[model samples]
Target: MSTPKIPILMDVDTGIDDSLALIYLLASEEAEILGISCTAGNVPARQVAANNLAWLELCGRSGIEVALGAEVPLLTPLRTTEETHGPQGIGYAELPEPRAELSPRHAAQLWIDLARERPGEITGLVTGPLTNLALAVKLEPELPQLLKRIVVMGGAFNYPGNTTPSSEWNVAVDPESAKVVFDAFSGLPANRQPIICPLDVTETVVMTPEHLARLAEAADSSPIERPSSTDSHGLRSQTSNPLVRHLVDAVRFYFEFHFDHKQGYISHMHDPFAAAVALDSSLAVLRPATVDVELAGTLTRGATIADWHGLWGREANALVAVQTNPEEFFEQLIERVGAFARTIPGI
Candidate 1:
């Protein structure tokens, strides 16, 4: 019997990991990418859309709709992390100029229209802030019921914040939008709840230099180079495969950023793991909760609090992923992406 294909719509900020998540979906035979919605987070909405187009062009995949969303959060001034994801959001990996045209539709409209067109069949994967998705929910209250599921990579429940004392970066960037999305999902069926891939679970999924080498080897790419902290600050990949080369250049920056923060030469493969879970929820061990984002306290704004024990007396609005296996995830990422890269026309 053939494996079931998942029709997925991606909402991303095109961070380093978001790029990887997009590529992983492209690599997977099971993912039928319906479209992509870009929001401002890692860099900017326009840059995010550009990264999406470049990646699609690199993988020789085409005709996917790429739309730009709001440039700022619902209620706050925009903030971007060029230091973390590089100015263009793909590290040192310079991509060829994209030849495809951007979708004329807005990201919010894309979300609303696609959900209406493919209700109960499309799984939405959001790997950035919640601006676009929140707007869609506000426009169409039935959107929560329309999507088959939403896999979100935000929040930091049960984990320390990477941004503030209490908030994850994505949630910290736009807490109001996050709150809106969670509130809209209240009273939805268990299947309709968003699978929250918060920092609690996502940060534990680490990517190391060895994993990069393994991926290159799996692709049969020549000159496998495992990036290290001791390497020069501007080292770039010289592999024969264009895909592996750009990936190495991109992830090396992520590894360096983590190392500089004393987190070792490793990157938390947050978004790609969420991408995998969007297709197969079994990849994560989930626990239902009433997930809400804090928007008021001076020190607690953007913090995500989970009512794991039903203390709130309301229905659980999200399914929070509490645990996942890093080893199992990396193995599949390597095997699947490596094989897929081999099939793409190399530069």
Candidate 2:
């Protein structure tokens, strides 16, 4: 029997890992990208869209449709943390001028239209704030029924948040939006409800040295090199480091900044892991449960609380992934990176 192709719609902010995840999806033999919608999250809304187009053009996939999504959070002011993403989200790679034209339709509408076109056949991999998804759910109540699942990379339950002590950056940036998406998915009809993969599980998935090397290999193949390392902003330092070449250096600097300042030893390839799990459940350990998002707590807003003990005896409303086979995930990620590394034009 032929392998079934998975249709995916990526909602991203074009963070470094987000770029890597997009490349993985586009190159995966089992995946057929439906489209991409850019949102304002880790980076500014304008930069996010530009970064998306840059990645597509770099990969020689200018044909993919790019939809610009929400600039600010659904019900909150926009939040940006350059400390985590560096000045530029994609490692200060001095992105080339965008070649992939932005779509005429908005991200929310694009999402709804695509969902309706292939009901129950599409998986939504969200790696940004919940603004776009929440807006889509609000506009089309029937959207939940059309998606196969929504694997989100936000919220913290057992693990401490990267932003606040209890709230992850994505969720904390827009708790109201997160609440809306969570409620919609939970309230959907039995068969229409999508799965939730909050940071409770994704936090544990980190990238290894092998993963970074693969990414570097891919970056080294970029055809367009910036004239200088200090982009227009004078942020990145010019370097002749062989390990940090072209775009790879930007990512390396970003990684080092985190390591030196926050002591974050591992790059938790968070978003892509969530996407991978949605594509292949065999990569994770999922448990059925009732996941409650805290929106009013002073310090816990955006935290995902799971009734894992069943102490409340509440009916399970979602599937929450709690663990993963790290070995399998890294292997798959490395393979995907290798394929993309080979696709760089004239490499």
Candidate 3:
């Protein structure tokens, strides 16, 4: 029997890693992406939407609706990581000009509408700041209860943060919104509580040079050829498969970012790991914890404080992923991505 595709809605900031996470979800057989909501983090909200639409076009999955979300945090100045994802929010790659426009509805409304339409079925995955999600919860107070699950790719529990000494980029970019989101879902029942893929687990799943080379090899083996009528401006027209070429170009910048930052030329598969866990919770070792986002601290703002030992005397409200098998994760990624590459039209 075939496995059931999990109905999902993804909220992303279109960072380099978020793009990879999008590719992972688009290629996977286990996920049925209902829509993608874009927000500001790695770049501005408009750029995030553009990147989403371009990526969907590049992957030939333009049917998925890409909706623009909050441009700034609820109570903070917007912060972006252009250095990490580069201009246009897709690293060194330049996708085809999107043939489609943004969905007519805003991301928050899409979230509310989808949750109401598919109550108790849609699994919402967030790989960016929580601005859009917080707004949706505010619009519909019972949004948390309507969704089957919420998988977040942020925080730095028991690990040093990437944005600051105490905060991950996603939460640091919008702590107030993150706080609202955490508080909203933390009150859900045990079975429906959110699952957080913090830095502790995501950092363990790194994409090495070897993996990139393997992906390129798989793409090269594909029978697809570039189309004669397609325009090649801003794209690597030399590669037979546009999707594979775009991915390689995009990851090059990410690889350099890690190398210069002393991470040994490997990119952290943060968002992709979260995407994987969203589909298959068995991909990671999870522990129940009472979690909250720190909004005010001289040196610890935006920190995800996960009380694993019940020291806070609070009931566990989230599942914190502590460990993941990198080998298995990469194997599955390679297989799914390879399968998708094979189906790409050579343009």
**Runs in model 1 lying further than 4 Å from the true structure:** none
* TM-score of every candidate: 0.99, 0.87, 0.94
| Candidate 2 overall lDDT versus native | 0.73
lDDT value, residue 134 of candidate 2:
90
Between prediction 1 and prediction 2, the one with superior lDDT is 1
Residue 322 of candidate 1: its Cα lDDT? 96
Whole-model alpha-carbon lDDT for candidate 1: 0.93
Quick one: ranking by TM-score, best first?
1, 3, 2
The 0-to-1 C-alpha lDDT of every candidate, in the order given, reads 0.93, 0.73, 0.86
Among residues 3 or more apart in sequence or in different chains, the pairs in candidate 2 whose N, CA or C atoms overlap within 3 Å are none
Off by over 4 Å in 3: 221-238
lDDT of 2 by residue, 197-217 (tens): 667676567654445555445
Stretches > 4 Å off in candidate 2: 1-3, 187-193, 214-247, 262-265, 310-314
lDDT of 1 by residue, 1-347 (tens): 78688999999999899999998999888999999999999998999999999999999998899998989999999999989999899998999999999999999999999989988999999999999999988889999889898999999987899999899999999999999999988887888789999998998999999999999999999898999899999698999888999999999999999999999999999999999999889999999999998999988999999998989798898999999999999998999999988987778
Q: Residue 129: error of model 3 in Å?
A: 0.4
lDDT of 2 at 85: 78
Stretch of 10 with least lDDT, candidate 1: 184-193
